[model samples]
Target: MFRFIWLSDQRWGQLEPHLPKNQLGARRVNDRRMISGIIYMLRTRCRWCDCPAG
Candidate 1:
């Protein structure tokens, strides 16, 4: 079982400004949640297919 890694509010505040905005897409998933999952996967050296579903 892998633990989820969520960004703290302070960290997210710093990161929020750097994310893309107003792109040509229908919509996007929750950036914070997606980023947290990516962080967890990389830190744990887990395969992309093994990453937990949202």
Candidate 2:
């Protein structure tokens, strides 16, 4: 969701400057994929261990 991304960006701002020399933030991802996965979980109300592997 847009709110999640906005919050993530704010987190990145606080993290970017203090990260260790060899570290990067989280891997970049397609927001749509994340949204879809979340929707699937919400609709099904499945346990985390049951999530389908990509």
Candidate 3:
């Protein structure tokens, strides 16, 4: 079975500073979830559409 991966608070803290903020568009919500999904996809070599819902 595949295990879901999530970003830790410390890791997110380190990454939070590098992410774009308050851009001229819709607000970026669920940034951590989005990043975690991307990381999961890359690590598991799974298709984006095949990713399991949280």
List TM-scores for all candidates, in order: 0.82, 0.44, 0.77
| Candidate 2, 1-54: lDDT as tens digits | 322222256655665676445447886565545655676677667688876676
List per-prediction Cα lDDT, in the order shown. Answer: 0.85, 0.58, 0.88
**Candidate 1 lDDT over residue span 1-54, tens digit each:** 557799999999999999999999779889998888778878989889864565
Candidate ranking (lDDT, best to worst): 3, 1, 2
| Root-mean-square deviation of candidate 3 | 2.4
TM-score leader: 1
Clash pairs (backbone) in predicted model 2: none
Q: What residue pairs are clashing in model 3? A: none
Q: Which residues of candidate 2, in runs, are more than 4 Å off?
A: 1-24
For candidate 1, the lDDT comes to: 0.85
